[model samples]
Target: MTGGTYTLLVEVPEATTISVGALGDQQFPAGWYAYTGSALGTGGFGRVDRHYELAAGDRETRHWHIDYLLGHPESRIRGDVRTPDSDIECAVASGLPEGPVDGFGASDCDCESHLAYAETGAELQTAVADAHRQARSE
Candidate 1:
């Protein structure tokens, strides 16, 4: 619907926040999070970025709802990239996170739209193992 940069920002479990440029300024708290959707929404990048901004005067930034609900466990942001082409959305739908996304449903990139999601510690580890298994099979 608009010409702009679109990217996904995921919060790695108590580790680090991985930003693909769509979300800016604010940082993601230590936890798993996946944001997929329009970067052109109101407040745009600021809205999503603020998700990680620890409340003023707070020791930890885990005061947000997502963080509180997740119980601040160790995890990582796990995801893959692809151009938004024919059937790309359907292909990535299964890759989305298990929770609600604070923004739109897809990211508009140069080659195509991209999708991403976060995973818990165990989930991240399992995904890694699965990748290895697939690699070995190949």
Candidate 2:
């Protein structure tokens, strides 16, 4: 599937503050994070693969706000909730709870933020999955 909306499930093993380009240094606690994004351009869902590489230390360039978090050695991409052939980035993000960082991935959109944080992986995953489902049904 390609050209869709996706939510990445990430885990931060330890607390740390990182500089997120123009967003400046933001504190991230040790926990799970869900980042929603759209892949409607040329490569489509292939963008998720690039994200995987970035999180795995196989890539270096930091192109997006999420890149800053993914680039950290302690952070990793666990899984993702994808809505193939759908474009509901903002809707899905809105359904989830607000994240710690403001304007994290909504520079081009009106979303308060596209990243959500949770105390556990299960909680984050459930929230992301439910958000996607709700967005898709709409």
Candidate 3:
């Protein structure tokens, strides 16, 4: 396994299309996330924190399919960092030191790092939008 982990921001009540089989009922309305067991850049925790801090700004808002499933009002983060063993995480670990991530929305591109420093509500919205756009495109 690779020495990497994924941080994800999922919306509550949203169903994530993670290759980890099925989320079942443990769905999140809206929040940041990092899949467990995957190598991450310098500020892995900081990046995910930006997606949660309410003051992160609007740019970090939710927009991906999982976020859409979560919808509005659910953007409020509801849980702590969760680590699950899934195919997605496993895949990510397989390719460490690659600089870019495979299953991650903002993998190796700008989209992935732009939200690393969500400091205001507006920035959060924009960051979320960026991830959402990336998710949709993929």
Instruction: Please give each candidate's TM-score.
Output: 0.28, 0.97, 0.29
- The C-alpha stretches of model 3 lying farther than 4 A from their native spots are 1-39, 54-71, 82-88, 91-138
What do the candidate models score in CA lDDT, each in turn? 0.35, 0.92, 0.34
Angstrom error at residue 117, model 1: 6.9
1-138 per-residue lDDT for model 3 (tens digits):
222234343333332332211222333223343222223555544544544453234443553323322233434443332232222343332222221223333443333221122324343444444433343334
Candidate 1: C-alpha lDDT:
0.35
Better TM-score candidate (1, 2): 2
Better of 2 and 3 by TM-score: 2
**Error at 72, model 3, angstroms:** 3.6
- Superior candidate under lDDT, 1 versus 3: 1
Model 2 lDDT, residue 87, Cα: 91
> For residues 1-138, what per-residue lDDT tens digits would candidate 1 score against the true structure?
221222233445444433323432224445544433323444544533443342222234443333332223333223322222122332333344343333323333332222334445455334433433443343
